[model samples]
Target: MIKVGIVGGTGYTGVELLRLLAQHPEANVDVITSRSEAGQAVADMYPNLRGHYDLRFTEPDADRLAACDVVFFATPHGVAHSLAGEILDKGGRVIDLSADFRIRDPELWAKWYGQPHGAPELLKEAVYGLPEVNREKIKQARLIAAPGCYPTAVQLATIPLLEAGLVSADDIIADCKSGVSGAGRGASVGSLLCESSESMMAYAVAGHRHLPEIQQGLEEAAQSDVGLTFVPHLTPMIRGIHATVYTQLLDDAEVDLQTLFEKRYANEPFVDVMPAGSHPATRSVKGVNMCRISIHRPQNGKRVVVLSVIDNLVKGASGQAIQNMNLMFGLPEATGLNQVALMP
Candidate 1:
């Protein structure tokens, strides 16, 4: 079994990891750490996992985590900065589901995250863990930085167009909506049920932190600097992200976008390229590790609209983290992640 340790097992992403790993055949949840909820039984906090995990939350101890084969950081952005390096130093692979090591530039990461990066020394060594794009790199990486919820949906939708040189990289718009869970398991006036329900408002329109990560991925696909306007809205649901991306086609040739996306993700296990003209709903991917995408060219015009959806906590965070772990260990990417999407 692949021994596993998780830091910050109290948040939506953390528990999501435990929930998924519980069903994984080759992965074992050896330790899960949380500073505030230390000593509490994992099931007491999350009733859904009551029968699945007997583990308790413990205060993060580097030496304790070092015993595991792999450690996942499902904490807030800077939290992983303090522990990731130590665990890696102990000869265990590390996968961070935070922004700590996702961006290539520490200065840019600090500019958006509002603090000096705690582990700048490890920045150069961290691999961006998007299995569709970096599968080979993840196989050899000792450290992996999983993409955020927003970036995962947006990038998967736009990368194919940008790489095929069929869309305008300079002018791209990613209009995204995410469920309340994306805000995390924290208390906030904005996240309150009364405040968030029956109402949808866009925050971080000026520039979301995920903008740079998305830009970084798109630029890498386009092989040039990219201009993207990413606006995130908080929806009333509990899981998933729906990104409606609009990009003007650069060439007016008879481009087959459906075929383009289908071929682009033909071999990807987690990405589902839906039939042409299909609108992927966020709920279709709720509670599972899947990205459902559809491509369209409106009225055969020079504009393409791509719709992408995924469970933010699954394909966006913890599930993708585990996918990286599977790659790092040479296991089938779908091993512990074959659960079908939960429906209403």
Candidate 2:
């Protein structure tokens, strides 16, 4: 079995990793680290994991963590890159659920994240961890930088169009909405129940950080630079993301919805394109790693709209991290991630 270690085990994504990895048959989660909750039973903090994990949270040690076959960093930005070098040198593969390594350009990363990158040289070494697009790269990658919640939903929705040259790269727009937990487990003024519940409003209108990351992914797929307008709104729900992508269609470009998507994602495990004219709801993907997508023709067939949804913590972060881990270890991509969506 592959021994796994998780750093920052007290956050939302960390708990999610535990929930999913508990069912990963080929892996053993040997260590979990938390600075503030060290020595406290992990189950005490989250009762959902009580019977599965027997250990308590502990402080992180570079050498001890390096001993595991793989390590997942579920911490916020600026924490993973600091210790990635030591872990890699020790032969430990890493999957980071932070924004630290997703953007290829260090200057753009610094500009968006508001801090200089700690490991600039290692930037090129970390593979972008969207399994559908980069599965082969993930198999050989020692470092996988998982995509952000919004970017994951947005990019997966539009990438097929961009790759086939069906849409103009310069006129893409993503109007996305996410639940409150995407902000993380920290106590914040904006995320307070009084402020968030019973309300829906848009924030980060013109300059959200995920903007650059989305552009980077699209450009990579299109083999050309892409400019997009991304706007994210906060909804009162606790999980899930719904992204509506609008773009102008290229002249003489046409695709049969089911046939084109099926051909493109034939070998992919997680992305599902709905039947023609069918709309996908966020509830259809809750508690699963599935990205349910659908397409539409509007504006007298001059433009196309793609609707996509996924559980922010699942396909967007922790679940995708585990998917990358399976790839790195030569295990089935859907080993511990095949459960049907939990519906009410």
For TM-score, the strongest prediction is 1
lDDT, model 2: 0.90
Query: Which ten-residue region of model 1 has the weakest summed lDDT?
Result: 249-258
What overall lDDT goes with each candidate model?
0.92, 0.90
lDDT of 2 by residue, 1-344 (tens): 99999999999999999999898888889999999999999999999998998988989998999999999998988998878788998878899999989988899899999999999899889999998888899999999999888999998888888888888998899999999989999999999999999999999896999999999899988999898999999999999999999988888886775577778877788998888788898889988898988888874587888899999999999999989988888898899999899887
Clash list (residue pairs), candidate 1: none
For each candidate, give its TM-score against the true structure: 0.98, 0.98
Model 1 off-target regions past 4 Å?
none
- Candidate 2, residue 197: lDDT: 97
TM-score of candidate 2 relative to the true fold: 0.98
Those runs of model 2 whose alpha carbons end farther than 4 Å from true positions after fitting are: none
lDDT of 2 at 129: 94
